[model samples]
Target: MSISGLNTLKKGQHYTAKELDSFISTTDAVLLSNNENQLFTDPEREYKVTHELDGFFEHSEEDAEKHFREKKAYVVEKA
Candidate 1:
């Protein structure tokens, strides 16, 4: 299935950054993973960390950064 953005992104699921970029460009949703998010995550917040719909999210937008800019996964952080 095609995802909308990073927030709506489910945990432990595999997704390509190229695919997500496409979804973000089409909406008002600026990636929450934009490093501007402060809270990151909140139990009371209904908003997902990696919001995929409008491409706009408040916190935890950087959640997808690792996947988007990974040059050497094992070499850098040993995933």
Candidate 2:
């Protein structure tokens, strides 16, 4: 399937189950999870971490660093 088709699925537009299955089968990169004996696919991309932000507010020092890194990586990947 084309990237445009994949984009459509990510947006939650109406599509037949068969179409979704076909697209999933053909994609090189896909997300999947095992649930209750069934394999489910995640259409959204995964997140990653890569930076440090404020070290004194919102969350504990550890958590704040983690979140900042994650958001930075997410932004970079989207770019």
The C-alpha local distance difference test score for the whole of candidate 2 amounts to: 0.31
**TM-score of each candidate?**
0.28, 0.27
Residues 1-79, candidate 2, lDDT per residue (tens digit)?
Answer: 2333452233323333344445556644332222322322333432221222222223556555433222211011110
The local lDDT score (0 to 100) that residue 33 gets in candidate 2 is 25
lDDT of 2 at 18: 40
Candidate with the greatest lDDT versus the true structure: 1
Give Cα distance to truth, residue 27, candidate 2, Å. Answer: 0.6
Clashing pairs in 2: 50-69, 51-69
lDDT of 1 by residue, 1-79 (tens): 4655433344334334444345445533334343234322332222233322322223345574422332111100001
Stretches of model 1 off by over 4 angstroms after superposition: 3-14, 34-79
lDDT of each: 0.34, 0.31
